[model samples]
Target: MIRKSFYMLWGTQTVSNIADIVYTLSLVTLVFTQSGSLLTTIFIPLFRMLSKMISGLVAPLIMSRLRLTSILMGSQLGQFVIFTGLIFYLWLSPEVSYPIIFLAVFGMSFLDGWTDPARNALIPRLAEDEGLMKANGLMSVSDQVVKCSGWALSGVIVAVIGAIPTMWIASVSYFLAMFFTAFIRDPYAAAGVQAADKVSSAASGAGDVARKPSYGEQLSEGWKILATNRRIRTLAIVDNIDTLGGAAWLGAFILAFVVEVLHQDASWWGFMNTVFFIGSIAGGVFIVARVKKLQKNAYLWMLFSLLAYVIITFFFAFNNVPMLALILFAVSGLPVQIAGIIRRTLIQQNLTPAETPSAMSALSVLSNFTFAIAMLLLSWIADRYGMRDMYVVAGVMTTAAVVIGFVYRSAFREESSPAYASEENVAVNKA
Candidate 1:
C-alpha cells in the first residue's frame, strides 16, 4: 500500500516537473520574442524565485493546519487554473503584457513552493526506513530524466507548435498531475484523528479548553526546530552555503562560459546541461544499486561527494578545452547528486512524521531565499569579473561548505551506526 502510494505520487511529480520546465521555456521564449529585452527575459526567473521566497515564508503555518495531501492537491489545482487561464489569454489576445505574464508566473511559483516541501515531507511517510535511500535515488533519477527530456523537448515543442500551444500542453500536464495526486492516501490521517480525540478528551475531563496555536507560534516552531536541532541546523547551513556559489550553473552564466570561454556556439550550452543531467542520472543509478552500502557509509559518501564537486568545479573554471570542460562538468554532477541524496535521506531519517512537514518547509524557505539572493549577487560578480571568475568563486564557497561539514561531521556520523536507526524510530514513536 505504501509502495503504491509512493509510486503514484512519484509519477505525478515527474509529470508536473516536466510540465513546469516546458512552461518556463515557453514563457521565456514568448517574453523574449515580444519584448526583445534581456532584462525583461531575466525577470521571469527573478519573479519565480521571489514567489518561492514568499511561499516558503508562509508554508509552515499553512502546513500546520492542512493535511499534506490537501496542500499537494490544492497547489496542483492552483497551477492548473493559472496555466489554463494563460493558455486562453494567449490564444485570444493579440499580445500578452509583461506584467500579466509575471503575475501568472508568480502565482504558479508561489504554489510550487508549498507543493515542493509538501512532497518532500510526504515521501518519508510512504517509504520505510530501509527503502528511504532507494526511494530518494529513484526520485533523483526520475527528476533528472524529466529535466533532460523536458529541456530537450521544450525548444522543439515551442518551435514546432509555438509557445501558446506549449502552454496548453503544460496546462494539461498540470491537470493530469492534479487528478493523480488526489488519489494519494495519507498514512497518518488515522493517527491524527486519534491524537485530536485524545486532546479533546483531556481538555473536557480537566474542564479546560485547549487553545490552538497562533499562526506566528506555528511558524516559530519550524525555526525553533532548526535552531535547536544540531543535525538539521548543520545540514541547512551547509546546503545554504553550497547554494551561495551554486548559482554559477544558471543558464545565462553557463551560456556565457560556453560562448566566451569555450568559443562554442549555443548548441554546446544544451550539450553541457545534457551531460550534467546524464552524470546525475548515473549517480542516481549508482545509489539505487548500492543503497545498503551507501546508507552504511552515508556521511562518508556525502563528504566525498562534496569534495569531488569542489575539486571538479575548481578545475572546470580554468579549462579552456570544451571537451575537458564537458567531462569536468559531467563528473562534477555525480558528487553533487550523491551529496544531495544522502543529505535528504539523513534529514528524513532523523525527523518524525509529525515534524517532517515543518522541517522541510523551513529548509525550503532557507534554500530558496538564499539561492535568490545569491543569484543576484553572483550575476553582478560574473558581469564584473567574468564567468570563469564566478565559477572559481563558487568552487571556493563549496569548498568552504565542505570544511564546515567536516567540522560538524558528528551530526552526519550518527547515520552510519546501527543504533541510530533504533533511536530514530523511538523518537518517531514518541512524537
Candidate 2:
C-alpha cells in the first residue's frame, strides 16, 4: 500500500506544484507586461490568500463526499479544466483583464487548499506508525523539488518565450497529473464507510459528524477546540507566532535590505528566496528524519522555531551587511521547517479524522488573521521607525514563543496522547 500510494502521491504532487509555479510566474510576467505596476504584481499573491481559507473549509467536505484518491484525482482534473478555461479566456481576452485572470488564479488556489490536506490525510490511510512521518517528508521533498525547479526554469522560459507558452505548459502538467491520479484507488474511497462511521460514532456519542453545522457553529467550534484543548491551542499559538512573526514582512525587508544594505541588485529577491527555499528543503528532510527522535523533547521543536524567528528578527534588525543577513536568513530556515512538520504531524495525528480539517483550518484561520493584523502593525512601525526597526518588534514576538513553549512543553511531550500511543500500548515509550 505504501509503495502504491508513494507512486500515486509523487505523480500527483510533482505535476500539480510544477503547474502552479508556471502559472504564477506567467501571471506576474503577464501583469508586468500589461500594466507595468508593482501593485498589480503584489495583489496577485494577496488575492490568492483567499485560497488558503477556501482549502481549510473545503478539505472536510471534499473528504466527506469523495475518497482520498478520488479527491486527489478530482482536484487534478479541476486544475486541468481551470487552466484550459484560463487559456481560452486569455485567447478571447483582447486585453489582460486583471479581474478575470485573478478569478482564474483564485479558483485554482481554492482547489489547492483542499488538495493538500486530502493528500496529507491520505498518508495515514496508506501507512501508519513510524512510516507516517516518513511519507509526509517524502511529500515535502517532492513539493520542494518541483517548486524550486519549476520556478527557476519558468523564469527563463517566460523571459525567452513569453507568458502565453508558460500557461500552456502549466495546463499540460495538470492533465498529466490527472492521468496519474486516475490510476490510484482512493484508500479511503467509501463515503458510505465514512457515513457509517459517523453514524456509529454519533450513535455511541463518540463524536458527531452528521449534524449540519451553522457557520457560527463552525466558527465557534473552531475557537472552542483551540481554547479548551491545551495541546491544540498551545501548538496553534506557537505555529501562529512563527508565521506572524515575519513571513509577510520578510519579503519587503529582505528586498530593501539586499539593495540598501547588501549593495546588491533589486534582483536578489530570487537569490534570497532560493536561500530560504534551500533552508526549507533541508529543514523538511530534517523534520522527517528527526520528528521521531524528538518525540521526547517535541517541545524543543518549538524552541527551534523561537530561535529561528529570533535569529531572523535580529538578523534583519541592525544589519547593514546584506550577505551576512542573507546567510542568517538561510540558517533560520531549519527551525521553521522543523516546527512546521512537528506542528502539522502532531495536530493531524492527534485529532480524529472528522476533526482534522476543522482543526487544521481553525489553526490556519488564526495564522491568517494574525498575520494580517500584524502586517498593519508592522507597516505602521515601518512608517514611524523604519523597515529594520520592525524586526525589533518581531524579535520580541518571536521570543514570546520560547516563553509559550515552556508553558506548553508538558502538553507537547504528552506520550499519553492517542497520537503518540497505539491502542495496544498504553504505557509511555520513554527511550
Candidate 3:
C-alpha cells in the first residue's frame, strides 16, 4: 500500500486541481461577462502563466529556507486567502476593474507555482524507492481524473448556479486542500538536504567561519545542479523540447485540426477530447497494474513511447478520416502516459532527495516557458502555413528529442548509478 502521507498529498492535490479548474472557468466567465472584452479574458491566463514563471524562477530561494511540507502548506494557505478575498470583492462590487481580477489571479498562481516543485520533492520522502513508480502513477491518474471529471462537473455547476456560487465552491475546495496539506508529514528531515551545502562550506577550515549563501545563490541553485549533472541536463533538454512539440495537442490546435483536417463539426472536437482523456486514464491504469515489469526497462519504455508519438503524430498529420483520427489519438495517450510516469520516476530516482525541489523548480520554469512559446509559435504556424505543416513541425521536434534520447541512451540505464554530486556523476554516471 502507498503510505498515508502519499494519500494525504494526493487528496490535497486533487481538491486543489478541482478548485483550479472551477476558479479559472468562473474567472473567465465573469471577466468576459463584466468587461465584454476577449482580450480581458485572455489576460487572465496570460497573467497567471507569467506569475507562475516568475514564481518558478524564485522558488529555489523559498525552498532552500523552508521544509517541503511548510512550503506546500504555506502556498496553499496563501492562495486560499487571496482567492477568498477576490471572490468576496467580485460578489460585492458593482464594477470591478480588470486589473483587480488579474492581480488576484497573479497572486494565487504565484503561490500555486511553488506547490508542484515542493510536492514533487516531498513525494520521495513519503514513498519508498521501490514503490516510486507506483506513487507517480497514482499521481498521474489523479491528475487525469481531475482533468476529465473536474472540467465537466465544474462547467455544469457554473452554468447552473452562476460564476459567483461556483467561486464559492472553489473557495471551499481550496480551504479543504489547505486543511489536508497541514496533515502531510515529511519523514526525511533536513539531514540529507542540508548536507551538501554544509559539506561545501566545511572546506573553509576549523577556525574560519563560512559565509552563508545569498538569496541569489539559492535562486540559482537548481540551475547550477541541472548544469552540473549530465543525465539530468540531457533529460531536461529532451523534456523541454518534447513540451514544445506537445503544444500541438492544445485545445485550440486540436479544435482547428478537427474542423479543418477532419472536416468535422465542433461536437467531434469534444468527442476527440473525451476519448483522448479516457485513453490517458486507461493508460495510467495499465501502468499501475504492470508497473513491476515496466519499471525495470523504464529507459526503453520511455524511448518506445516517444517512438509511438512519432508514428501516431505523423499519421495524425495526414489522416482525413475522423474515425481513424479518433482511434489514433486515443492510442496516442497510452504511450504518452507511460512516458510521463516513468520519466518523473526516473528523475526522482536520479536526484538526491534534497536536490529534487531545485531540479523540479528549474524544470518547471523551462516547461512553462517552452509551453508559452510553443503555443504562440505553433498557432501561427497552423494558421499561416497549414495544420498539416504545424503537426509535421511538431513531429519533427519530437523526432529531434528521440534522436537525442537514442544518442544518450546509455545515460538512462536503469542500473546506472544514482546522480552523484556533479563531479562524480559527470565522469561516472554513464551506464
1-431: candidate 3 lDDT, tens digit per residue: 35688889999999999999999998898889888989879998899899999999999888877888888888888888999999888888888878888899999999999999998887766776456778888888889989988878888888899999999988899899988988897876666555656644764656577656677777787888678776778788778888889999998899999989888899898888888888888878878898879867777888789889889999999999999999998998888898888777777767776678888999999899999999999989988999999999999999898889888876765345432223334336533
Q: Write the per-residue lDDT of candidate 2 for residues 1-431, one digit (tens) a residue.
A: 15576677778788888888998889888887899899888887887777767566545545555566777777778878987998888878787788888887788777776676666565655555556566666677677667767788999999998888779999999988888877766444464366436544564554544555444554454456577666677777777776666654456766765765567887777787888778878887886777568655556765876676687768667887777767877777766666666666666555544444455556765776777777778778877887667778788787787778777677655544544223123212211
Model 1 lowest lDDT segment of ten: 414-423
lDDT of each: 0.83, 0.69, 0.83
Judged by lDDT, which candidate is best? 3
Top of the candidates by TM-score: 3
Clashing pairs in 2: none
TM-scores, all candidates, are 0.92, 0.85, 0.95
Question: Order of all candidates by lDDT, from best down to worst?
Answer: 3, 1, 2
lDDT of 1 by residue, 1-431 (tens): 13678888888899899889989999999999988999999899889988998998899877877898899899999999988988888889987778888999999999999988898888877877557788888999999999988887898989998988888888989988988898888887665445445544564666566556567866776777688767777778888999998878877788999999999999999889999999999999989898878877787788789899988988999999999999988887788889998888877776656667787888988888788788888889889998889899999999999999999887654424231233345243221
**Model 3 stretches astray by more than 4 angstroms:** 200-207, 418-431
When sorted by TM-score, best at the front, the candidate numbers are 3, 1, 2
Which candidate model has the greater TM-score, 2 or 3?
3
Q: What clash pairs does model 1 have?
A: none
Q: What C-alpha lDDT, on a 0 to 100 scale, does residue 197 get in candidate 1? A: 50
